[model samples]
Target chain A: MERTRAPFAALREALHAAEERTRLPVARLLLLVLLLSVPLWPMVDSRWLRILVLVGIFVVLGLGLNIVVGYAGLLDLGFVAFFATGAYTYAILASPASPALQADLNWWLAIPVVLALGAAVGVMLGLFVLPLRGDYLAIVTLGFGEIIRILLLNVRGLTNGAQGLFNIPRPELGGWVLRSLDQWYWLLVLSAFLIATAVGRMRASRMGRAWEAIREDEDVAAGMGVNTVKYKLMAFAMGASIGSFGGLVFAGFFQFVNPSSFTLAVSINVLSIVVIGGMGSTPGVLFGALILIGLPEVMQFSETERLLSVINPAVPFADTTDWGRQVASARFIVFGVLLVAVMALRPEGLFPARRPQARLPERHESTA
Target chain B: MFWFDQFVNGLTVGSVYALIALGYTLVYGILQMINFAHGEIFMIGAFAGWAVLLLLGGSAIAGPMLIVALLAAMIAAALASSFSAVVIERVAYRRLRNAPRLAPLISAIGVSIALQNVALKLTGGRDRVYPRVFPTGEVGLGDFSVGYIQAFLIGSSVVMMVGLIVFIQRTRTGRAMRAVSEDRATASLMGVDVDRTIVTTFIVGAALAGVAGVLQGLWIPNIRGTMGFLPGIKAFTAAVVGGIGSVPGAMAGGYFLGLSETVGRELLNELPGVSLPNEWRDVIAFSLLVIVLIVRPTGIFGERVSKRA
Candidate 1:
């Protein structure tokens, strides 16, 4: 075990050293991120802005998932269920499409409803798999995700079947009509910032330590007087609440809700983010979203055709559409392979979450 | 009579699921890992069977000659699936044997994705028609008629299940498999040839899946790359509902799940104003899984479920 970790320790040291070199404090880092993105706001077109919004949303999702899988050591394969629930909840109660509501609710008003729904569902999931751990939990959660999607797809009158809900009323902030993509983009960015801050602080809290202990070993965690079940449920509720924010923003941005948008692949993609970025690393989640979501946008069909066509004039543009579709389909394969490779090689992820070195063993012994 | 017909229909589908579920049980017994890619392996078997038919003068030829061709296709499929299962174990699962239990499962998901994509690529995302090698005709009256394909599926699955039990109880390789599953290190120490036994467990499990795949194609008359996924999940659900590592439990669970599905749909259809769309039939499996988990986490037959899969 030590041998397996030797390389990672060295890498961690190198990373720490690099951080020391660029030793910007938390306030500076936040300001730097905000300042750097200022140029991108005006330069990017709506298409690019849409991609950026998705990236931010994913980052938020990754962070939320990081709390569960990373800090709490749970493998949630059905997380998209909660995301779907949040989005669907928003669409149902806050849109004209829902005949039951008959009135489109305000975005601010809908946010709490969505959070409460997400939290309730999260608790149900936590309770459902209270006895299950690891792979069993994963598969059951996967079933849960599928069940939600199947329900959404089949509930004809309510969900509008496969055609999906469209033309959702734009979100309003105290009577200001928030219609532009830029406004929604900022909403997401702001949400991402808020969620990340909450998650970051949660990671350092007493409850957070209990989660870490549970993640390391449930038996030991329980032995230490930690209410493992309650904390586990709390983690789920927290992650769900954060993810619901993403969903609410998602519906607002597109003014659309579709069952097609939420799938196992989405859950897996967020899992990959939590994984590839760095399990418990807040910044890692952001980086994970950038690579997983942003990289794919770059590789989308249109981009692929232009690049390929430029390289070879004889290449027919029309035929490249097939190539594009194949590539799009192939992304899951790549992600899957990447997941296997990454988990096997570096389970700690690209940016291993930094724990306080001096405090590690004392916590372990205390828990013990 | 409507209920009886649905019951019969459920039994036919149930047998195939039982065959697939057996694969899950066998692998779970030995390695204690959920072979997520097992379904794709089943799909591969179907495709291999289809390829054999195409090679052996296509579907245009029929009669006694077609039976011989079909037997050959079944063998090809079993062999193909067995081989693929071994490869998956070696490439994706071997290294993670002692790692966290979740590692292998995640890796298996990767293999599942890769294999499913391979199938999609090969079939060009379309369902491949199984050459109608056998004359499929109903052999009953009054809407209670059973088709030859359906009979063959139930009969063959039963035969296979019985054969597996006999092999396990009576054969040396099977004994070694049981020994390894009981305790791998001890089995290795006791000269059980642990690695080979594990490989054999995979082969046997995958062979069953392959046969199920062949039966499915023959029964449904269409094979697709993605076909393994739904059945695979259903079979696994069957395994879990029955008690994951229990062979008999998987069989019972499969039948129960299958019956519930058809019967539930039948019941829903019969109830006025509560007729759900046909697509909601898929919900039966998911709901049953949740119900079983909530009611009996260890499954009906399982003595105990490990904290992990």
Candidate 2:
């Protein structure tokens, strides 16, 4: 009797190649769907448009965070600090209510300043925690975030303390001041698309490879001549800059900026988006933002209220007329449960990024 | 006299921080992951204690009955917190043992948020007021005075710390815990039930946090669902300052932070042009954490953490 192998290795390799071939088209199709939705923005209800805008903003934030947490593997529980920095920077420059540093600045000029400031803040925080690793870095970053919030609350002379900044002027493109939901929606969509494209390119660059190495094993990456410190700082700066952009838009949309608005919750929300969206996957981020941010906003509809009440009449409601608000308030609980469930059941996330494949040397016919 | 009063206050606060820090240290020792939800366990403990106190007549109960009620509350709180911690370990942490480091942390944060919101929903987002049970008065020794509750807090904290030290040094489970922390794979190979040991670690830490929660309620006289957040952060600071994963270091760190916030703040204010606000205490604590990490990443009593931790 003779024994023979089934050529399992070659079969697996072929299957993987097929998967890689199929994934690109699916990703492109998802992007196409997203881009095709642009014209429908004006057709949707203003209320729904507002929610979509919010979703777009978070999509940008999620992509930014993916750079650090996904590509770099740094668990930054204090990413909100950068968000607050951007918001405050914009509010102080553009808001008339800014007590001490009111510049009555133009939003166009403020964009560069806010982003640069955001990157600087990121670099500063990055430097402080460079010596730390893993959980220590996380805790330290969290502390840094709290310190910023507390400073905002206490720095009465400059920030107007807990009163916050209000009456921020709407962003302007040339002579037209953007105020309507559709206008902001267009701006957000454009920015989201630009950011997505840039990020996608970055993910394939040498820097992205370095980040991937650092994330996998920092010491080993350093041993392999990957300048871990420089790359980590670059990740922080990049993530922070994009997060600040989210903050800038948030201020413009609401015409308000408060320390309370930029709490740990915001960081958690962005992080949840990145984690749930599939880390390094752009399409996954878009999907994540829709579920985490968009779903909650849509839950505020009266239809959702009716849907809920029919499901369980015993559901506790702080306000009967606005039952949707009550359910929306409990979204954090849902977020929590979803986080645990996702991590335990599918750590790779629902829309995981395609892992980079290493090409093997060609097999000789003699080997068969 | 003012300094003495501050000292007493520091001691009382420090005691609570120490107890919570112990839980952090113990868990970190074995698992090397910060149990971010540990603070919520402490809050649950307080709620459990509050429930018992309410059942036992709350503020109305007096004399010998007060002592019994207090004991019951402490025990109940411990059980509740231990239960919560065990479940968190099983549900949130157990499976992520070999997963990426970030997965368990994210799960823990999720648990923290969920537990906090659930507690908030349960309590109608209102503070659960603890009935004032201890008689109002200060025990004095020639201008150095301490409140009855403060004294109890200090005394019990010391007792627990001593008992824990003894247990860790002498008991079989304690030895297993130490062994697991030292080298988990080797310890398991040596026949230690790694899963059970991890669960025990969580239970012990949570029990201490639970007890501290009740003690904190007695002192503050009110407990809220959100009460655990700040204390949890502070206790983690204490754990880190004392060189995390070291029990004795945790105790030292807690007292150090407590004293610095109170007495140390006062001392700083004595400097020219220094009128520090009360809130600056938090800033000070965090700054201290940053400084320590920069200067001595291993903490005061922490061993060489460059290798594993």
lDDT, candidate 1, B165-186, per-residue tens: 9999999998998888888899
Can you write out model 1's per-residue Cα lDDT over A100-125, one digit (the tens) per residue?
55457787888888898888889988
**Which stretches in model 1 have alpha-carbon errors above 4 Å?**
A1-24, A27-47, A174-185, A301-329, A356-368, B140-144, B268-273
Model 2 spans > 4 angstroms off: A1-44, A313-329, A356-368, B306-309
Listed in order, the DockQ scores are 0.50, 0.50
TM-score of chain A of each: 0.81, 0.83
Q: What is the DockQ of candidate 2?
A: 0.50
TM-score of 2: 0.91
Question: lDDT: which candidate is best?
Answer: 2
Candidate 2 lDDT = 0.84
Q: What is the C-alpha lDDT of each candidate?
A: 0.80, 0.84
